[model samples]
Target chain A: MTDVPSYLSPTGQEIVFLLLGVVAVGAALLVVTTRQLVHAALWLVVCLGALAGCYLVLTAEFVAWVQVLIYVGAVVVLLLFGIMLTRAPIGRAADLDSRNRPVAAVVATATAIVLVTVVIDGFRTAYAPLEPGGGSAREIGSSVFRTWVLPFEVLSVLLLAALVGAIVLSRTDIRGRR
Target chain B: MHVVYPAVVSALLFSIGVYGVLARRNTILVLMSVELMLNAVNLNLVVFDVWLRDRLHSGQVLTLFVIVIAAAEVGLGLAIILALYRNRATVDLDRLRALAEFPVPSPEDADDHLPENATEETAGQASRASAATGPTRPPGRDDTPEATP
Candidate 1:
């Protein structure tokens, strides 16, 4: 505890993480506020990609790659397909926001203030020096199979359930039995 | 790295997600907001995993699980949304108030909700409220006619 580094003189990792954090937060803000539907999804890509970078900086290399593959690659493409299928306007339209924008803004601001205050107060002196290889693919894979195997298997079942549910929901001919 | 930086960033991202979910009118946009919130949680998990150096690396493993769940959620959500659009021909959250507490009033009841001396201002207010509730007609009754054609 006494050996924690001072924040006044940050290290290189801290600098890179802060820059990535700024990009993530900004892109996330843009994702929510953008009027153009397509643009919002694009901004989400930037945001998620930045988050992956943050994960990398934090030394979770496996999680970083998984984040990029699942979120930035697959999820964004699905959202884009959804946008097109729904015939959302190609360009910006005025009604992207609902009537309670001000209320939402207030609530979100309050949430941020409370969360940031609590985190900073609690973790003011806490520091964790990054070490490579802890989150390497081999380490995480072995851990998944060895320690978290049950949950991992359960998650696969959940994925299969979701796949079937989606198919059933989307296909008009799949009527439920009376 | 100071733990505060990632924690603070994740907090802000979650708040932005809260705002998007509350304020966005499109269902898909709301889904994107949900993803943002999930990613924020993932960041927190990864940060803690790195910090704690747990023997099992539970935090990172859980992060991977969360990502998988998020993918499944997006798939199901998009399917539901597509189904909605097919039947309703629109995906605006504001317009999809079928289950709102205030059921849309009947033709006769519409007059009762408004005063006899209703001005344009009052009429607008009344209509807006009604629109928010939407018509509570039998679901199949509305779409069936169109679907058969």
Candidate 2:
């Protein structure tokens, strides 16, 4: 068989992935540690954008676009609106509740360790190379509409519920009427 | 491209998101951090899904679902924040300590105490402070003169 194209080779992909991964991580760190709320939100956008890049690198074009359309586009806009409406303190709070830092750190660390171990072990034990024709958007469309129909419908209902819950929580006259 | 590298990148993004959620205190910022984590997860799912490249296309479909949910989450989150702002002048999470079981403040009385000046002043102060403090200004607040210092 002829050799795979150099551009499509695993090595090339790895380099791209490495660069994007570093960007994603650095952005994420900024998102969490930054003192300013708006800054954190902006950093989150960077992190999410980097994630979209990762998906693109993986050749999951559909997922990458969805990530942008949903998380970056819709969710982040909502977050910014929340900040604006609530008038969250512009400056970092003098003391932003450091009481739970130790506990949160311990739990997060443990979770990370366990997750990393499981993922690594899984990769090592079940390393199945993907077929060349895999990851096409057309195939994904069919699968979502066909096999995953039930879950898809359920998800719609769940979204409806969330919408209703949001409305109820935001209603100004709930207690007033009673 | 090889899926491993993207997976690693996704992991790093996820870890940083975790750190943000843990460290940040502003509710809006915290929510933003959650979005970051979600994006990271979305990257991992898409990367692996692409690699699998089976007829199933499991990852792409799941990513769609995540997007939908994230949209709904933000809509609701913003509403809650608005209500909270009405009840309490500040959206600082520290000040919302008793949100769960606490009595909602009466709007009639609450509106009178709303921090019109406080927010304006803080915004102004943060801008001036950033210039005065150093070139490294914190993230969210606009450092403009209009904001009362």
Candidate 3:
């Protein structure tokens, strides 16, 4: 029930994926553990960029670009604004960490082990060959509108709600002074 | 070469995110950690979308939805954090225990390192609040005003 992938050797793609994976994982590790707030944000950008590269290697071109646009371009820049607004310590600082690090490490490691084991066991030998035009924008758009209409619309509503909630929460009325 | 590579990498990213959330004291850093976790989930979705070879590309669609939702969450989360900082001065999670039965003084207070702007803004709010309440109004905290983690 299987055929060899003729497009290119899997090794090339695999190596690229591994490279991107290492970059993404290493940067993500920094994102959490960095004491400098701005450096943490920048590291998050690197992690996101590497994930986008992974998506490209997997042949999900649209998703990869969207990953860059939404994550590296938008979300991280927004996070930087948050840091500025809150006046987070710009450089390294010891107060950045809490005292529960040992507990955190345990929980995180346990979760990673469980998830990795499940994934490896479940998808051990499955392979899906990529065909050209598989992840074209037209294809994704048509499917998104036709099959996933409800969810797409619901997300639009959710975004609107979040927008309103944020504005309401942050309102500071000098008029209340009078 | 194994499909497991992407999966394992995603897992590592998610684990790091968990550690960030649990161990970081700053609110913005916590938000950044949440983003890391979300990105890990996106990686898994795309990897599987290609692996399953589904006709409709449901995995990628779902990833799109997730990205949009993550954006919405960050927008709202940052707004709330900004508001908290404006009111309380410091964005330290341990110090922002307003809901505790015995509220602890913020770390800024213990160290007497309250930012000058925080003090000024709070004083201005207090002065304005008091004038608005007037002598006839009790100095009690009303539901109209409140403050955050």
Candidate 4:
């Protein structure tokens, strides 16, 4: 903390990160505030992709790729499928927002103010010099296999359970035992 | 890179998610907002991991775990939403109030409230009566092909 870099001179990496962060935040705002149902999902793709770029700028290379693959690739598609299957209106409808928008806006604004203040106060001088290869697949894989194998295996089991649960819930033929 | 950049971005994203979850009427939209919130947490994890440079890399590993869990959650949630749409014929969260408790009518006003309660009760009773007649059938079987056709 004593030898922290001053905020007056930001490195190239910080500049790139802030740019990507702006894109992500803007797209995320569009995702929530968009009136069209399908358009919201598309905006979400933009938001997630920008976040992936942010991760790359942060030097978490492996996490960035995974974020792109899992979130931008699979999750957005799943959400689109959900929107279509539910027969959501194709064009903008007026009632997408509920009556609680004003209250929600107030709460969200308060949350943002408090969180931003706390984080800025706590980490004002926490500068991390970016180092390449620290977040590569080789490093993360070795760390995961060596130190985090138990949780990895448990997560696989959880994924399998969720898969089975989804199938059971969606299928009409699978009746529970009374 | 200053840690506050990612931290502040994540905080704002989370607040947007909170707003979407509170304001959206559609169940699927609510799910999207939840994903935003989860992504915000993931960003926080990755940033902290990079900052600390831990030997175990717990932050990145946990971010991976959170991603996997988020995938599972979206799958299950969409299934539940599909089930809800199938049963209720609409996915509007505000209208899905079957389990909401309605105030019981006081005896003094029972006479005037008869019409309103009658309408509500008959809808409940009709559904109940149908269930009573089909004791051998499985409950919530409306999606069955034979039942549909």
Chain A TM-score compared with the true chain A, each model in order: 0.98, 0.81, 0.89, 0.97
Clashes of each: 0, 8, 0, 0
| Stretches > 4 Å off in candidate 3 | A1-10, A174-178, B100-149
Model 4 chain A weakest 10-residue run by lDDT: A1-10
Ranking by lDDT: 1, 4, 3, 2
lDDT of 3 by residue, B1-149 (tens): 45678888988888899999998989888898888888888888887888787898999999999999999999999988876676666788866655632233455664654434454345346546666656454333231243322
User: What is the TM-score ranking, best to worst?
Assistant: 4, 1, 3, 2
Candidate 3: tens digits of C-alpha lDDT, residues A13-78: 788989999999999888888778899989998989889888888888888899899988889999
TM of each candidate vs. truth: 0.88, 0.72, 0.83, 0.89
**Tens-place lDDT digits, model 1, residues A12-109:** 99999999999999999999999899999999999999999999999899999999999989999999999999888899788899889999999999
| Residue A72 alpha-carbon offset, candidate 4, angstroms | 0.8
Candidate lDDT values, in order: 0.87, 0.64, 0.80, 0.85
* Prediction 1 global C-alpha lDDT: 0.87
Candidate 2 chain A worst ten-residue window by lDDT: A1-10
Put down candidate 1 lDDT per residue, B11-127, tens digits, no spaces: 999999999999999999999999999999999999988888898999999999999999999999999998877755668786565464333435664454353322223334544
Which segments of model 1 are wrong by more than 4 Å? B100-142, B145-149
Q: Model 4: share of native contacts present? A: 0.83
The C-alpha local distance difference test score for the whole of candidate 3 amounts to 0.80
Model-by-model DockQ, in order:
0.64, 0.29, 0.55, 0.71
Candidates 1 and 3, the one with greater lDDT: 1
Candidate 1, position A147, lDDT: 95
TM-score of chain A of 2: 0.81
Top candidate (DockQ): 4
